[model samples]
Target: MSKHNDQIAELLTDDSFVRWINGDANTLEQRKWNRWLEEDPANIAVVRQAKKLNELLWFEEEQPNTQKELKRLESALIEERTLPSEGINRGGMGMALWTKVAAAIVLLITVVGVIRYAHWGPKEPEATEQPIMATTQTGYGEVKRVTFFDGSKIILNANSKLTYPKTHQGGDMQVELQGEAYFNIAHKSGQEQRLFSVLTAEGKVAVLGTKFNVNTHSEGTEVVLEEGKVKVQKTNPKDRANKPYIMSPGELAMLFSNKSNIKIQNVDSELYTSWKNFELKFKNTPLHRIADRIEEIYGVEVEFSNKSLREIEFSGSAPNKNFEVLLEGLRTLLKIPVTYEGNTIIFGS
Candidate 1:
């Protein structure tokens, strides 16, 4: 099995993880698993896979007698397969181990088959049976472009991931995002237009074909509209009851992690969306803010030799396609000493 399959198999065999997936874990176990997820956001994807597998394995509460089901499943596997030469034992212990491994591999194969069918299956009414889900990701200092079947496009920023369906047909369309992206949503024709939405851990942004930028961070999420309009809502209960904030072009909507209020203000959309064009526009933007961008894009730590250098402002544009190019431009434009030590970038002599 592949590394991912190995992870899923390991997770499936763990009692705590199984309980967590079934939502039967105690409060302490729940808290522990929650913390594990919060520590590394990437774990969420793995957990999602595990949950899907668990669901398909008849691990739900509706299962008619889980013990009997397991016995039937194990007997069927045992009858159909033989153990390896080394693990073969008359005592039945090896059979048990082989059964578990085989079950996980079967589940993996089922998932792959579903994806394959989505790609190559007949294009009749069965097309909607398996909605093809696609994922686009960019590593540190890397960017990616994703275009939907409808010609709508998204320029995903560095250290970002977007999970969306391959097609935008069938009612409202939605995509889940982690990190930042610039969206150029295409308007659907006809009198009834389908609503498009972007979902983040912070909240959701609903629109009807618009140009916008969404940035999700540890603190919260920010939506900057460049063209058309968008509606921003907060998922937190304290703010959920309130109506979503309707936004216009050149407007910014913010939802803070700790705050229950959704704040709206007018802003220059270019400053936020400029990265989509491989450029960073600074209008009296301070060095600290620049450092923040460098850290975010390059996945590095930034420091200032003198704290006051952080407050120094610059009004210019710099190429962001390459970290080295941006760093060189900053050095010449700021007329300051910029050096790198290990993975950390330092400004000031």
Candidate 2:
């Protein structure tokens, strides 16, 4: 095997390469992989097979634990490369280390194909570790609390769903969110620390330990950090030019749905975060947005009959009060006629 071939052989065991194969590599790492493939045409096939093997092992969420089989396949390939080769036809190709790797991948894929299609047809193979799936959801006018095994707590707001796996192979503690939720992540210090991430349609919020609120809607995604620090990324794949926002305490990151702009601003974090405590606090917050929050929190439809009222701003606080008291309070504050109908509140006339 040539030096380059040895490098290629060593690449299979490289963790970064494995991460790239699993779609976890950052941009620089992805570029490095691309550059490596461009340097040598043969590197393309090498990486392709490596990725195929990785995808196969991670194909299904409840896939059989095939880690041992992968290691055995790699080991067997190296051992077989030492066989007698005086007149061994390498299929008009050199007997390089890369060739052995490609051959081994093919052999392993064929054997696994037989086992998967024949033995495990229609039924998923049993595995030592089961797929971890847990979820918490809240309907309109409702709130829910979920505690993870790692002692982290999530206070989900109305019209929200949170789903998470137990933990990832690389010590990743991740969750997927739609709508709104407040996270009070437990600090997993020292060796117990895990990489925690909150993924949404807009992007993701990553932190080791922090208290944050994530609100993802059709309009945009908002991440407000109350304690500690977090990185909120605008990770829509179609828009790659947006940079990720690193938010400190009392900071908010907003990624608008229509644009690739990520804006960070210092804010009264409590106003955006106090919902979990059944408090609605505002600091000259726009009336339209506040109405949206009111509807979300109480399942009551709030609408400004006129466009002018929508642009009005309000500054006050309201506990988890019923609809009439809240409507009368707002009417007194803004001096507007508040009409309460069945399940709907209108602030016009």
Candidate 3:
């Protein structure tokens, strides 16, 4: 018991051992502990016990019964130590060692418990008000139409998710979007005109009765207005002081997350909004953009072995309802090598 007490005291006094147990060890301290374990494998049980004790003391909501837990831990350590080592029975030595370690284990538990109680203790969780949210998700190659109580309609494209409040109490009709979706926001006139905002990872699109197509991708969020008007704002912290970009009919707004500016352009609305009709219309669209759409819809990674293959443009319409049909058309029209390896679609042999 005195021997065990001496070992525990020595380890507690060692800053490296204490830091390692507390998971605060730097790279050098971690290497030091690893070397100690490799040099003396017998110390593994002590290290594990110290880690478990620390976890039980800190993460546990209710105070643990120190006496009972200590006894169980002591028994586990004794059993682990007594196991046969190197084809020889070390049961007798393990029992004697554990008996010597009992007092040391108790001292460690007492000291750690006192410190924990003095500095940190379980806290009562504060109550938080949470809004009731309703979410709609579409799987790969599947399109879904969601209708809201205010007669607003949203057509979610494949592999997209939309979350909004279950009911509108009338401040701002806000919803969050991930992936691509086409919006036909209901027109509100007079005092009933509430701003309809679509939140995305890149930015927010605020509209008052408009038809638009929004696609969220790795680069950022793209918004193409079919009719009416919409305001686009980038969520970048540096651009927070800047005013939102306004878009009119036949205008496309791109909100880049990494950049502090929003890009607005005039584009053919059909090129972006035709997907809702189970087809995709491309007009001199680059292969990389097509690959982005394919990846976004089918949830498959598209890679081009040749960098120049991504620059090739395609001008045609393809059936988007069937993924294989679209890939077949791409292969036939492009006359390039398209191969499927697991979930990845590789172009150029």
Candidate 4:
């Protein structure tokens, strides 16, 4: 038998879970499902895969656009299957793992067929099945915790919006993100390991399972790895010739939208990821970079009177505090001048 066969089978056949997957769960069933997720964290990844298959099944059955999606998947799979296996001498992503998973399922679509394969998960719901989707948006001063049926949770930062399907596709997961979020991705093992991926305008980050942070804006996309590894692929047409960068724990990947080159550096993960804990930390970080982050988090603007202010590096941690108090702490800690004008903060004389 294949790895994870028993656990996967149980989840796919669970009566209450099946109702929830097909979006037919009653109030009591929904409550029970949530309780099941809480009872054992390890069950999260298994449940997530089941959800993905459910969404794919529903989409193929009800959506008018299924043909278009299937065609794309077929092309991708054919292309992906023909590519020679390149040895990984380095750390980053090769061919996208998501594509491979999609291809594996596509073969099933052709053999067992789409409709028959769709029924592999559970008994079809009598009610019509539609594609599952949900979105969460947070205010500038707010942070929200989004829990996926897979048990993976996302801590969405202020002024951010995240859109995700109700379930993953083919047991591989993908998400579209705008703004910033820290992901505590649930890990899948056995056959499904190494299938979690994030897509941004700048590029894509793929991993089997890991803790990481992703930030995207007009400037570019930044990925910081706290634990585990990730493959960061550059998506620019101009940089198509560039090699994908693989990052290990304690490393950072910066992909600029305007340039084809990617920059990699070592960083203190706490400096980049501690925001979720209401802690701001720095290690010889420049004031201007600090100002930029303050703007992102507080929804305010910051200006330095002199260009030199942008290059001053200091080391410290700022306790999670209100905007004004944080600026005051900076001023006192650095012995520098800081004044506020409405929502904007100006530094240096």
Candidate 5:
């Protein structure tokens, strides 16, 4: 027999196969089924096991109502089909017969239900539930600017994900962040003012009306304040639970993951926020550090083949030029030969 026919037979007998049958099958599914049947001699054996389990569940004489029987059949089919292939013996007729019986029972039960309930009136539909909030993903080298319902704005950096409620909750305005984002929150009065919180890997940065930039990635969590103040608290603070740092403007907080240590530094807010205007400003930054920042901003990899070149420090501002121009400028300044292979920039002697 053809492998496809055998698989169909095996599937018919397997009890757990019901799940696959009832589940939605799209274009790829049909193609997969065709492919499976076309390949492998053991496909037929697997189908038989499914058929047998299905029959046992559906063919019971004392089976409940149509809906109940359908549910039972589905459950049994799933269980039987999921069984290990090693446990199935293709050489035996007992397995084949059992699968055939199960298949027959399920089919008969389904047929009877269809005949009896064909004229049954449809029931009123239940009240619709609120839809779940969908996650927004930013691809590599892509950035997105989104404005919230409350007039707050978020600028998502490359390769980031931002998930928020579909409908704003009155008690608290909260957003989950992964990667980097710059927020400009709108001022609100009364209880609404006290409810603004931005959740990140480090902790929750709570504010009423403030502007801040948060970077949460594999490297670490960084929060830079531009306007107003924000209270940075570790979501799971152990000892200093009561004391949360109130970050003011012109201050930057760095929370290192390797050690649960926090470092506060004085920063030039305008230079930090230069990316907002599509500019990369480097002030006495190491060549390696500059490469790291460029990789993060543009979602590209930079490799310095020469160890000596990696230690060199660069101090210059580069317009948000195209990748080629940026590379050429860096090469000219560092006096090193650089080549671009796909997305990776290689610096060599």
Candidate 6:
């Protein structure tokens, strides 16, 4: 092959060129792509050779183990590249040296191909090293009271998921949570000391076996302390070290996503944990926001066609009756007729 032909062959065999063929062509600019394809007719032949090699290696009856195959190929390439001494016979020695050099070139190409394939090929499934803990899920309009082996009690609200280990690990009690839950953790007395933690999407709450309630959804996360004290820290730290804020009883830790800021204030603990009793309490909460919470608790869809009603603020408690009855009460309070259609509730004229 000519020098230009050799260069074309090398480019065609490149892993990047293979990636372009394997569905990454969009990454190349239009002009560069056109120039590459128009380089030479021999380039097409080189591409075909690469494609054939790829098919032969990947489509065989049973593909070999990638690591083992690469290791064997490397050993063979090393043996093929070992040249004889200069003192050897000139005739056969020259032929042997050329053979070794040619073999070395081929081996180099194969090694490059192997490395690229190992990186871009179908990955092997990795075995899970740790066993998952027991998980509990609460459906819509449902609530569950769970008692852990360590004597901690958790009340999971509607559409909530809680996962905890079957057996308590020494030193700490940890539980992963999604949605809303009220926890009444029992204290453990020992020289080693015991810690309790609740893990959520926003962060993790660590306590010395205290009572707390955690409410988390797409909007944000809220931590309320009913008894004892707790420390809140971001699970995935943005800075090099995490900053934890401690909250005493009757305090609330509100984490908002817009500014990624945490606000701590004294709050009425009953307002936070009232959902456990099926009572909805709102303190200056927007009508639309209340509707959203009602929908989540009842597994229904709420639509406020009258956009004006969304700006209204509601403050009071509603009974834990069925959704229809609750809507009837709201209708009386707001002086607007609420209509229910299947699973959708609409607020309109």
lDDT tens readout by residue for model 1, 188-284: 8685466788977767888889999999887889999999988888765464456688899999898887777788898989999998888888888
TM-score of candidate 6 to 2 decimals: 0.59
Best by TM-score: 1
Query: Which parts of model 1 have CA positions greater than 4 angstroms off?
Result: 1-132, 167-170, 237-241
**Candidate with more favorable, higher lDDT: 1 or 6:** 1
Residue-wise C-alpha lDDT for candidate 4, range 8-105, written one tens digit per residue: 77777788788887789999998988898899987687778777776666543454788877896787567655744332111112213422442343
For candidate 3, lDDT tens digit of each residue in 233-281?
Answer: 7765464565788898898888876776788888999999998987878
TM-score, per-candidate, Cα-based = 0.62, 0.58, 0.60, 0.59, 0.58, 0.59
Per-residue error at 130 for model 3, in Å? 6.3
Report the C-alpha lDDT of model 5 over 1-349, residue by residue, as the tens digit: 4766665665665444544454545667656755775697665555455555555566546755899767877875774455332211211223344333433332333222111111112322431233244344443444567787778888876546666757654435567677777889887897565456777666677788889988886656788999998877665467453357889898988765554556789887765666655566777677798878777755568998978877777766665534555666777766678777766778775
RMSD (Å) per prediction? 20.5, 25.9, 20.2, 25.7, 20.9, 23.5
Once fitted onto the true fold, the runs of candidate 3 whose alpha carbons sit more than 4 angstroms away are: 1-131, 236-241
Report lDDT (CA) for all predictions: 0.75, 0.70, 0.73, 0.71, 0.63, 0.68
lDDT of 2 at 5: 57
Q: Candidate 2 vs candidate 3: which has greater TM-score?
A: 3
Highest lDDT: give the candidate number: 1
The regions of model 4 sitting more than 4 angstroms off are 1-131, 168-170, 191-194, 236-242, 305-307
Model with the higher TM-score, candidate 1 or 5: 1
Model 6, range 1-349, lDDT digits (tens) per residue? 5775666567666777667656566556445655776897766766676666655666437766999868877886666445333211112213344334433433443312211111112333542123246666554555678887667789887666677766544545567777789999888787646677887766778877888999887756799999988888765476545578899999999765443557889998987888877677878778898788876665668888888989788778876544545676777766677888866788867
- Model 4, position 152: C-alpha lDDT score: 84
